[model samples]
Target: MREKIRSGGNAGRVFVLVAVCCAAAAMPLTFTGPAVALPSIGRTLGGSPLALNWVTNAFMLTFGSTLMAAGALADTYGRKRMFLGGLAAFGLFSLGLAFASDIVWFDILRALQGVGAAAAFSGAMASLAQEFEEGERLRAFSVVGASFGVGLAFGPIASGLVVEAFGWPAIFLLVVALAALALVLGAVFLRETRDPNAAGLDWKGAATFTLALAFLTYGILQMPDVGWTDPFVLAVLVAAVVFFFAFYRIERSVARPMLDLSLFRYPRFVGVQLLAAAPAYGFVVLLILLPVRFIGIEGMSEIAGGRMMIALSAPLLVLPIAAGLLTRWFAPAVICGTGLLLSAAGLAWLSQFPVGSQPELLVWPLLLVGIGISLPWGLMDGLAVSVVPKERAGMATGIFSTTRVAGEGVALAVVTALLSAFTQMNLGPAAGEHAAGAAQRLGTGNVAAAGSMVPSMARAAMLQAYNDAFSALLWLLSAITAATAVVVFLYLGKSADVIDGAAGEPGPLRTTVMDP
Candidate 1:
């Protein structure tokens, strides 16, 4: 029976999703341990704080930029085939990181790893789309969303233990092992999902999109370090706009395109896209900011901070299951709207956290935040994909994925800049003296003076940075969510509406694809 064959296909799809997701799970883990040990790393490697910042930014920029191209590639090649190839590349690059000799090499390898990650995730999603019916899709999206939270939760703890015990090299060694295993599982089980005969590959549109993303991302990253008015930044920004315009032009004219630019004509699609960006920005920045807060401000050890951070993970794991179940009884918008409100509340609650607050005391906010984050993410993604045609699923998914990553990328840069600028503004003359003292201590090789000076100004600067950063992010989340609510009411339209070109109900409500 067709139903039986579809069900059988679902099982293979779910297995592939898990395998590819496992590779995605490996990414943040590679950074977590190193991030926790940043100060120690700087001391050991003779790098400046600025240089160390690249460790995270490089990976994010590359990951965010290449996703669209990878999606195009998956749409062209068979999704399963592309996915397995990506996993192989991912494993290889991750292994390369294990042997990196310096900070530059480490950062380079991390970027390459991100490239492989983009390929794997995009291809995996493509395969998933072909495997499951619309009714089961939300659950699959939930699993994917939850995997990110799980990875974030586990990576730091795992990385901390390894880094503290055997140093940063051990972290990548673990990645190598995970990558190798993923390759084996992926090749053994995954099946091709894309129909090669269905559509022509839009290489020109894809190239333009890639260059646009790269330019835009690099420009944003430079904003933090070089300031926005710098000629190079201006040049890149202009080039990005040009390329993005060119992309639109190409997509509009092409017979078969990578992205269906007309999708933006739907206000619901636009709303979800913007709404999706906000929470992503909030969470990714939170992941980076919180650990620093726990360790630097609250005086928790790196290991202790990593463990306490697990509180955020618990709800992430559970909320997706709750969302999946609720789909049977509730509408996606209702669930998504509620999730947005919860996320806003959680973030606002987190804003109340005073400097040096205990992690245990903030558990409620974490719970709200986790639930808030999980619900809208899964629902929004489901809603967005449901609106698009199956043939254009890769492009739809890519655009959505790009928005999510771009939001996070820009958010991190903006938040970091704001945090840095705000902290410096509030540093009150003492910062200069503190920096001088630290410099002298380092100059004279007196780690004690450096340590002592590090107490007052360093601690205060850090506290101020975390405080401003979290508060700004909270407000940003609120505004973005409120805007999303407006978009939903205005453009997302009546509940249970049918997407054009799809055989479905005539309301906003749509079913998701799931594993058998």
Candidate 2:
């Protein structure tokens, strides 16, 4: 009877792992799928560039901002409850997204969908911590990470095929189905868990942080359309600064803050945060930007674009696992820093090719980027908690995850604005008064629409202008990534010590219950 019970317990844990992994896979699928379908969404919905951007931006904004708060809520309220509720909300929102007719409704639903994603992801992660321990826990998280990789690896191709066949709505339908399966499994297998010492939700901090990011993203996304000096843009940009200050104040004053501001005092902790954000500018933005460049700007078929994206993302499926294995021989800092430098090289190499370069010309650089980013990606989660004291592991994890996701949203907005600015400058004499308008369209990957707005003779010039702008953007990204690599390397070097007052010792990974 005892043996049978032990075997059943193992079986139950396996089911729980499957449930959480399903939820993990769905999140990235939602994130990457829309990028592949952005052109289709724009065509069907007929929204402006700003509105179209909100399709991806809205989801990222809420998801990233809500993560910390969601993690806290799960800790206090019960992980299983939050997980199931979040899954249900995610499924409902995805359903609404599938049927959304107007771009406005679609954007609203996408934002709400992000909230659900945050809640579900935080809750699922917390529950996993409770379900597994020590070596088993590491294995479980590895499997979860692999599940996420599978989604990122195939999301573009899957979305492209779906969009080609059944339209953009089908992508959301797929998410809905996945959410449903996860919900059912979680309902059956998940056990409720909570932090007994958890404090009240930091409403002020959450509000201020959310507002700061929202204002900043809005101002940046709108700057290209309405000049930077436009009163409304300036006003929102100022508001962003003020709210960020307010968020800083709130977190410091709160007894149990969503983010422990003190963590920044530790160089290694700060380094980990920076490392988390590096991929946003270097790699994540490309997930969206490249799809648009291929299908919308270069006029490649959706299937072809998706296939090309595979070269950029497929390395993730194996490189992350390989990174973990390499840790036995090399320090995580050396591995991660070397990886970013490699990615910088890839970016610089890719810049030599024009926007419409053939897949053969682009594959190697794209593959290099995938291989480079994966090393750091695999190790970041482990590094986040390891750098801090065991007691603060949960907060460290939450803050690191928040930085990563939020940074992606911010990077996408900034890169989009920069691309438009570059394109406008390149189109100077040829486009004349229509330069700004054409630049906006081209920046958003609406090449067909942008061409129609300009003279037939100037269209060739416009395409060439876009290519130049893209090349300039890649070089800028490369430089920033390389600089970041240097900083991360120095701060996380052997001289760095754990925040727990340890001296001259690299932080070791411990079995702590992470809340996020």
Candidate 3:
């Protein structure tokens, strides 16, 4: 009976699994394309710094805010139900983008699309957890991770081709089609799964967290346009701080909180979450800033710009599989920390290369980053879920995924602000103000506008400004990665002979070198 109950290898089940992977890969379809299309989108909508950024930020903000709530709902109701519903809503929202005549409507539609993605992301993770057994589950997730890498590797090229052929809105239209197919296939093939013992929804905690995320993101996004001291930005920042504190308090007080406040007490769990979120932050800056240098500043085609991304995403496919096997020998701390060190090394090396340098020059470093991110990708998630009780898989998955996407949002805004501020600092105040606006546009990957805005200054100055921005971003991420590596090392210091003395078990690391 147990074997029969656990069996999920039917044709429908297999198809549904693949479909879910495809859907997850497709979710980020719009994330990269917008980097290429933002200039065009801005042309149609008017290129204020805020308008340009909101195109991406709108989706990220809503997606980050709603992910945990969606995960909690999946546990309470049905993973399959929420998964399918998310697909439907996301598809509808994507379709709506085709008719967006103004930037306001575009932002609104993008935000709604994020809501759909949150449901899809959390539900798919929980649904997969429900379907697979121990060893097989790892394989399933690896395939899913590979699918995402494939999508990212191809995204810039695909979006470039589509945007160049049609227009910017066509990108959303294409996503709508992809979402619709996933929706139909999922509805037919996937079965419902939910926690029978769920304590129920925690609306107050949800509201508090959501407000905190929104306000914080808003403040970060505004920092580029309005310096950090603007009264409105300060007020919003204070509110965000208050909401975060309130969220922690509410979760602690509530009988059924959306987030598990106790989970943070686990050093392993928090370390894993940071590991998961850190790469996302690094990747966003890479994706947004690097491509703009290629397409916008260097005058390359979108296809060429996207192809440049391949060097970064391709290693993701092979290294993760190797990393899985490596878990047997290396402690999670050693392996994950090494990955971070390598990633930081790569960024630091790449930061020194001149702007418009050959892609060949960039490939080795990019590959290192790809390898680095892959190392702890699946390993961290496995560790995170293991620390929690089995029935709360949905909650665990949601928390992990939320941290990943939310970190991407905050980092994107931070990188944008930092890039713009640094450019102004180097360029001088009177002319720097104009250069600052151009620098802001470049952060969105709008090379043409940035180039056009240079006040009769040589293009060399703009290129230098861009190089300075890129160097700042690289240095910042490198510092963060190096710091994270130290922390992760301390937390997961034990990896040998910790799991029932089993040779290859994947759980909490407890083999401290100091004890020996």
Ranking by TM-score: 2, 3, 1
Instruction: Please report the candidate that would top TM-score against the real structure.
Output: 2
Which whole-number lDDT from 0 to 100 does residue 52 have in model 3?
A: 71
Candidate 1: 10-residue stretch with minimal lDDT: 503-512
lDDT of 2 at 310: 89
Residue ranges of candidate 1 with Cα displaced over 4 Å: 1-18, 27-34, 46-50, 128-146, 198-201, 296-298, 389-391, 428-473, 493-516
Q: Pick the candidate with the highest lDDT.
A: 2
lDDT of 2 at 165: 95
Give the TM-scores of the predictions, in the order they appear. Answer: 0.82, 0.95, 0.91
lDDT of each: 0.65, 0.89, 0.76
lDDT of 2 by residue, 135-170 (tens): 688899999999998899898999889999999899
In candidate 3, what are the lDDT values of residues 1-516, reduced to their tens digit? 423333446655676777788787788687887877776677787757877777888888889888888877877788888898998888888888877888888888888989999998878877776566666777888788888777777888888888889987888888887787777777666667777666667888888888998899889888877787999999999999999999999988887778876767566667778887778655566877777678777777877787888888777777878887897898777888898888888888888887878878888888788777778775776766664555544456668878888888878777778888887666555354476677687666666677677657666777787778778778888888889988889876744234223323333311111100
* Backbone clash numbers for all candidates listed: 16, 0, 2
Error of 1 at 359 (Å): 2.4
Clashing pairs in 3: 494-510, 494-511
